[model samples]
Target chain A: MRLRADLVPQDNLSYQDVVLVVDVIRATTTATAFLEAGASSLYLTAGLESARAFRDDDVVLAGEEGGLKPAGFDYGNSPREAKEAPVGGKIVVLSTTNGTRTAHLAARSAKHVLLASLYNAHAAARLAHQLATEEVAILCAGKEGRIGLDDVYTAGVLAEFLQIMGSYELEDGALTALTTRRAYPDPLEPLHLSAAAQALRQVGLEADVPFCAQIAASPAVGVLEGRVGEALIFKRA
Target chain B: MRLRADLVPQDNLSYQDVVLVVDVIRATTTATAFLEAGASSLYLTAGLESARAFRDDDVVLAGEEGGLKPAGFDYGNSPREAKEAPVGGKIVVLSTTNGTRTAHLAARSAKHVLLASLYNAHAAARLAHQLATEEVAILCAGKEGRIGLDDVYTAGVLAEFLQIMGSYELEDGALTALTTRRAYPDPLEPLHLSAAAQALRQVGLEADVPFCAQIAASPAVGVLEGRVGEALIFKRA
Candidate 1:
């Protein structure tokens, strides 16, 4: 088996059997938490308009723009909010600045797409190992078009888990992620030191810092099942 | 002062006072070793044809394509060959797969561009600290527009040196580099584990592997002083 890790999703990605999209601090983290807390499924929309269009009695609209809850949204992109929401048997439609875009991008190219973060890294790795067809791509949702430390650090963590799970040849990007994981063994260090973390702290959302830093807090593995209209539906695997 | 580290040069880079382009595996390392071993100067060419065009009695042409020396080139992209060449008082023109392209790209956007590698990382850091106008951008000449572990590890080493030399706020990329350096304190580990190193070993150029791994082996810092038509002229600083 071969594992390829990309710091960000690029336009030229070839076909992969499995693609794991990571957005720590805290998009995928929140989504995974919602699933673990009994949300039936998540509709990952690429924009605020698409997410809002999915509003219904059985759907909870959650997302953030510029780190603030969009006007009239049910919740911001916070794992704490996802964990506390009354999401039992509900479909949570979500959109965010970076994570949703990455999910949709991966959905267009890979046969199977899984959401990964510190909350579900190990679970995602295990699922990937079980389903991969000789190749797996870990795509980090970098801040805008640039590499974000938080996502890269989480990718490193996930890469390490996959390395330990099987005998596989890793590409350069995977080696980079492994090296990053070795550098920051404590997940909290990357959380506290990341630019996204600092931005959150500045906005007085300091509580989300430690919450997003919890590694494997949720056993949920979010796999993209199909698309419902303009949203990609993710079911827990 | 502010330090921004990029895993690879992006098309939308902002203006910087000083840009340090690094390709640690071979190109910049080889150039630094050449200058340290009494070469008067280097002419960094972006293409094989351009490098050949500059060939004269006082100039030697060198480069590599697909990890092999091009036919009729005076030398390959190997520090061992560069170190042994009698380049005293002569100009050595070089073209490589990645490094020269990065040098030219940085030259177009920044006031000053310098070549860096593990061999002259400390020297490049010191020079950047001395000459930067409140901002320094470290651009890693990654392998074909993707992140290369050897270059990023060398960038991490240089970022650590810059942090120790002055008071500066590091961007996320720089912080990542510093963290990587902290993880692998011994430079040889990254060199041996890098994809470039493995390729060199496969090609039977194993001697260049350890030679390129030597930190601070050369005090030469390649500063782009001028351009002769399409070639960038470098002088040791």
Candidate 2:
């Protein structure tokens, strides 16, 4: 087995059999929390218009752009919001700045796509290992064109879990991630110092910092099953 | 002051005032060794043909393709070769796989470009600090568009030095590099475990590993002053 780590979701990411998309500062964290909180499923859309169009009585519109909730969105892109929202047995239509776009892009080429964060790193890694694929790609949903520390740190956490499973050959990026995880065993330091975390704190969302920093808080893994028309449906893995 | 770290040289890197291009596992390391070995100056070129075309009585063609010296090249891309070569008062024309290509790309936009490696990291950082440019970019010459552990680790070493010198806002990549440096104070561990190091050992070139791992072995910083016709001229910074 071979494990590859991509610091950012570059254009050509269609080669891997399984791809774990990570946005630890809260997109994937929120998604996993929603699943763990009893949301039936989620429809991940990249554009705000698609998310709004897919919303209904049974669907909750959750997401943020520029760290602020949209005018009519039901919830902002916060794990705290997902934890408190009425998501039981409901389908969540989600859109955000980076995470959902990365998921949509990964869905184009990846046979199986899973959302990973510190909250669901172990579950995501176990699911990837269970798939028994030759290659697993961990794609970080970096902020804009640059890498975000929190996302890469979360990728390191996932890489560490995958490495512990045995019988895997790690590529350079994987080794880098593993080394990173070893260097900082405590994930909270890097996350608190991350640009995304600082932005959240500036926006008076300091509560989200410790909330998103929880590792393995949820055993739920958000797996992209397939597309339902224009929406990418994520089922619990 | 702002410090930015790019794990790999992405396309169109036309943003910084001063760019420090690093290839820890041989190119920049070898170049630093050559300059420190009493060579008057070195010429860096990305293409083999360009390296060959610039050769003259006083110039020696040195480089490697796929870890082996080419048929017509004067020397292979090895610091050991450079350290022993009769390059005294001679201009060494150089070309390698990743390092030179990254330097060429960085030259397009950067006002000043310098070659950095573990051998010359401290010197490079001091030079960057001395330049006092508003923005400084550390571009890692990654292996085939992927992050190379050796390069990133060396970048971290440079970042650590720059951070200690003055107050500067670090971008995410810079913070990641700084964090990496703090994680591994001893540079040899990551260099030995790097993919490039394994490849060198496979080809019976394991001797280069320890030679390249010596931090601050050379105080010379390879600064790209200008081009003579087609060859890039490097002076001691």
lDDT of 2 by residue, A66-87 (tens): 8878879998888988987889
Which residue pairs clash within candidate 1?
none
Q: In model 2, which regions exceed 4 Å deviation?
A: A12-14, A228-231, B38-40, B228-231
Q: Ten-residue segment with the worst summed lDDT in candidate 1 chain A? A: A7-16
Question: What is the total number of backbone clashes in candidate 1?
Answer: 0
lDDT of prediction 1: 0.85
Supply the DockQ value of model 2: 0.58
TM-score for chain B of each model, two decimals: 0.96, 0.96
Query: DockQ, per-model, please?
Result: 0.57, 0.58
What are the C-alpha RMSDs, in order, of all predicted structures? 2.1, 2.2
Q: After superposing candidate 1, which stretches have Cα over 4 Å from the reference? A: A228-230, B37-40
Query: What digit string (tens of lDDT, one per residue) describes model 2 on residues B1-237?
Result: 999898877784476688889988889999988998767888888788888887789988899888888779899989988888888999898889889888888888888898899888889998988885698889998887888888888888888888889988988888877767777767888888778888888778879988888887789888988887666789877
**What TM-score does the first chain of candidate 2 have?**
0.96
